[model samples]
Target chain A: MRTLNPLYPTCPIRNIINRMSDKWSLLILSTLNQNNIMRYKELNAAIPDISQKMLSSTLKRLEEDKLINRKMYAEIPPRVEYSLTKTGKEFMPAVDMMVNWALEHFEEIVS
Target chain B: MRTLNPLYPTCPIRNIINRMSDKWSLLILSTLNQNNIMRYKELNAAIPDISQKMLSSTLKRLEEDKLINRKMYAEIPPRVEYSLTKTGKEFMPAVDMMVNWALEHFEEIVS
Candidate 1:
């Protein structure tokens, strides 16, 4: 009967939050927010079952969006470290909210 | 060095939140939370640019997940309305957290 309206430029709030509230982005932020910085491998371990492809892709997205900064070290195997930018640190409040929500609402899903 | 640990059964927390925190789901919940119920056409008007396929798909997902209840009316041209379930209302606090986060961090995206 009517058209579906997506939040684009004018309603970028939903658009941007959609970016941060995704599968990998949520978990990736959970990992980085607790540490000053983490190399790629350590971060992967922090998240038990993330794929390399998804991790790399998610990280790249956060990097592009300025949520996280990636620093590369010249090494035999190439070392890289990831840290949340100042802008990213602000997002942690939302992340904390999610964690608390998860713990609080965990029972709802089971029942 | 390691595989992506996508949150599944053990980590169903992130998995479930991922389902709730999506493009249409977020906006749709935002709409329904403000109102007890809304007809299909009425809900469409609330969101400015959502597509028919996505709205239908997103609503269907939320319905299946039990976040919202869909009621069909025996009326001309077939009438339907959407409402959030008990579990759905429980999700609103987390949604509020997101809204607050967005308002606080809106400048980061453009800066």
Candidate 2:
């Protein structure tokens, strides 16, 4: 009979994966991973399908989680940029592997 | 100017991670990974907090996604066992990394 690990009372992995598993979180993270930094409009353009509400809310959540850094530049137009933090950058290797896994087993998974 | 990868249209990674990111999926997967094979009751006991409904639904989803296999034996009481599929086994390294990242950044993440 296997037992649960006592160290994890609430399961932090669940919290972390739950954030990563959101429909737009990984997409935003992936986009930011490749771009290094992106403006709000640029991100909207990159992922044409995401709604303004979703993009903004997801960005806020990611920022709250500390996965992404948000920087605001006061200018004539008021600009903000999004980029992966060190922790977020570290998580990207796993994300890449996940994409590769999906590609490798695409047929098997679909069929 | 970074552009979206043309290879992914609807983003298959989203589907894969969505399945994995479920609150219970990784926990169940991590549990199954350690035990090799477990009976339904054993799994239930291992994850004591998960309601029966959630456990059943999550297991069904995992099976549908082809990440785990379910086997049944015909008998008076009947027997069922769950184990990770080949693809599931392959994904464990990434899961391990995520857990490690969570542990490494636990302090920063919570604060």
Candidate 3:
């Protein structure tokens, strides 16, 4: 196995994991994974506990990271929607594995 | 898919991910995954950038989460070693998948 240097700023594993490891990113990603597409308000409503500020910033970060795309429509009030990018969609299998593991081990670890 | 509440303290996925999501824990876990068993100093040496205090605490947290085991020998100088617990070992396949994904997508995500 190749050596992993967690402190290396550009290390792929570090960079990827850092992005996913944040408190809200995975949840948001998984939320989009299930919903396919969501409006900003729908996402905020779905993740009830996240503040509007956090949700906005996390969405922006995901967009900047190329994990999710934000689309705006030219309409009366304007419609903005979020969905996982192809790369983001590709990443979900790993996240699914993690979610399954967490479900299986939740009691053992959290207790 | 089940709904995930990121803010829920007892939510299994959140709990497990939070534990693995820290700056050092996954790196330490992956290091141990590769090494099988290592002494405290060996771990410290392997990850050149981690501070002694942070290493000690992260190891403790992993142990507390039942991810790793600490063994001490009653010798003249005393010997201490660390290795993954059964649960920790079980969790690594998921980590491996994430690592593989990171390697494959590094350029696209990090650029």
Name the best candidate (by TM-score). Answer: 3
User: Which rank order by DockQ, best down to worst?
Assistant: 3, 2, 1
Candidate 1 chain B: 10-residue stretch with minimal lDDT: B1-10
DockQ, candidate no. 2: 0.37
lDDT of 3 by residue, B62-93 (tens): 99888999999999799999999998998888
Candidate 1 yields a Cα-based lDDT of: 0.77
TM-score of each: 0.80, 0.88, 0.89
lDDT of 1 by residue, B53-75 (tens): 88899999888667899999998
Query: lDDT for each of the candidates?
Result: 0.77, 0.80, 0.83
Q: Candidate 2: where are CA atoms >4 Å away?
A: A1-10, B1-10
Give me the runs in candidate 1 sitting further than 4 Å from their true place: A1-7, A73-78, B1-7
- lDDT digits (tens) for residues A3-33 of candidate 1: 1124355354454677778878988887788
User: Which candidate do you rate higher for lDDT, 2 or 3?
Assistant: 3
Q: Name the docking class for model 2.
A: acceptable
DockQ of 1: 0.28
Q: List the residue pairs that clash in candidate 2.
A: none
